[model samples]
Target: MNKEHKIATSMYRKIAIDIAQSVADGKYVEGQKLFGRSVLASQYKVSPETIRKAVYILKDMGILDTEKGSGVEVISVSKAREFVNRYHEIESIHSAQSDIAHWAQKQTQEIADVIQKIQFIVDTAERFKNSSPLTPFEITITKESTVIGKSADELRFWHNTGGTIIAIKRNNDLIVSPGPYATFREGDIFYVIGNDQTYAAIKKLLFE
Candidate 1:
């Protein structure tokens, strides 16, 4: 149940959607020739005819174009992948047909203006999630640093500044999750994780 039978009939279309998604994600750049039918079929565990059928769907969507002897090349891809994911959520045959039709219609519309808007939204969301610039950044312990030649406890880095040294790169090796007993050498670069304000305080404690 659960549309597996319909999946059998529409397997080629699903395969085409996957190929289109790869194009949209920049995995397969535009004008890049795809593998031959047999190779693609082997990769997807399908028959060569199935691959051919999928290529036809992509060609119809304008995501791919096939020349006489040359293989298919990607043309353009927008947020077309949403339709691929949406198709799996459809319950009825009518809904599935309607979804595919809508996807085809949108393929012909203008989407160059929307990609930048979508990218801006994505960037703004990331910025909102990561509001601090400190972000577990790294700093090398120079010879002029006050904290050099001092143990973590002797320096009382956490006492003066709330930053926690998560790791230290000494020589060519890495000391991970070091405790307070871990000594700081002149050349050891410490990777610390703390709030934005705490890292600023740590820098002041180290150099000044």
Candidate 2:
């Protein structure tokens, strides 16, 4: 890899390790507040994105609770230990109970971090897959309605009823925005978009 890429990757890993160790060592004990992204970014001399990435990793490990608007907080040591114990066989593995407990807590946080990372990827893929086109269709509009004529009440009413006017095809032209000021004229074909229910609602509105 290039020098810059290598350095960035190394820095990212270092940041993750530092956060994990801090949580492990009780440097930022359970329930204690951690700085927000902007604050941490300044403190660590890293970009906001870098701080976000690090915080997200910590959050996945269950070591941190990052609530939007509220800021990040260290998870309770007891709770952190509890989670760690579930993923690993802590009780039977060690005779020295205190050391075992400490190790278990740390291990649990690590596992949580891994799971969170994997889950994020899985969720993103699922969303993309679901968004992929499963089918295609052609519709022709037969009405005259302008955004000004239809008004906010009509647009909202349509949206609330699950009917969406996807596009407006005027003479030799296509207007897709269909914004608040948009309009539909007679012979203007509208490309309505939505699922079965939406399609059904459109048919009802048009026919009725």
Candidate 3:
């Protein structure tokens, strides 16, 4: 949180708690009149506004009674103890909320960092693929392909597409150098290599 907010909140809350504790301890008994706002501010080394806020908290909790021109008076020792207990409970909840917010922010940052790293890796791989002539391109066999269920030898694969199949990925298995007799199956990922026009020829021969 902001430093100014911390000072404003903590100072007045501390003063209020101190006054309530005094009342609870019998240092200030019930029905006893305490100093005015300015005098209490001077005594506590705070501004009159701070004293007013502190007194307001006590009065709101029924621990103190305040009047405009008169003064502050202790109303109930039991209520003073209740106010202190309630303040501590609220402080505990605030501390837990702070901890949860801190961790959530940290996790969000870590997830962003991971996404950035993955994007960098993907961009680097794409650059390498585009720069290398030997890197094989991939195409998936679909139901529309005329070559589906046909063996490479029967379709005269290399003669038709002017490309060489390096591997066929079927399901979880990689069939490296699937020779002329290897039949094309739906969902097969063909890893092939050729000149620039080879991919277009393969697509035309298979789909058109």
Query: Per-residue CA lDDT of candidate 3, range 1-208, in tens?
Result: 9999889989999999999989988899998999888899999999999999999989999999988777889989999988878888999999999999999999898677656654654464456468865345788999888878889899887998887777777885566667889898999988777667889988987778
lDDT of 1 at 65: 88
Work out the TM-score per prediction. Answer: 0.38, 0.35, 0.49
Order by TM-score, highest first: 3, 1, 2
lDDT at 35, model 3: 86
All models, RMSD in angstroms: 18.3, 24.2, 13.6
Candidate 3 residue runs with Cα over 4 Å from true position: 1-14, 25-27, 31-33, 66-71, 133-208
lDDT of 2 by residue, 20-116 (tens): 6666667778778877788878888888888877777668877788887888988756545554454346434554687778899988986776566
TM-score of 2: 0.35
Predicted structure with the largest lDDT when compared to the true one: 3
Candidate 2: regions farther than 4 A off: 76-208
Per-residue lDDT of 121-167 in model 1, one digit per residue for the tens? 34643564498543566789899998777898888878888877767
lDDT, candidate 1, at 207: 90
CA lDDT of every candidate: 0.75, 0.61, 0.84
Residue-level error in angstroms, candidate 3, position 29: 3.7
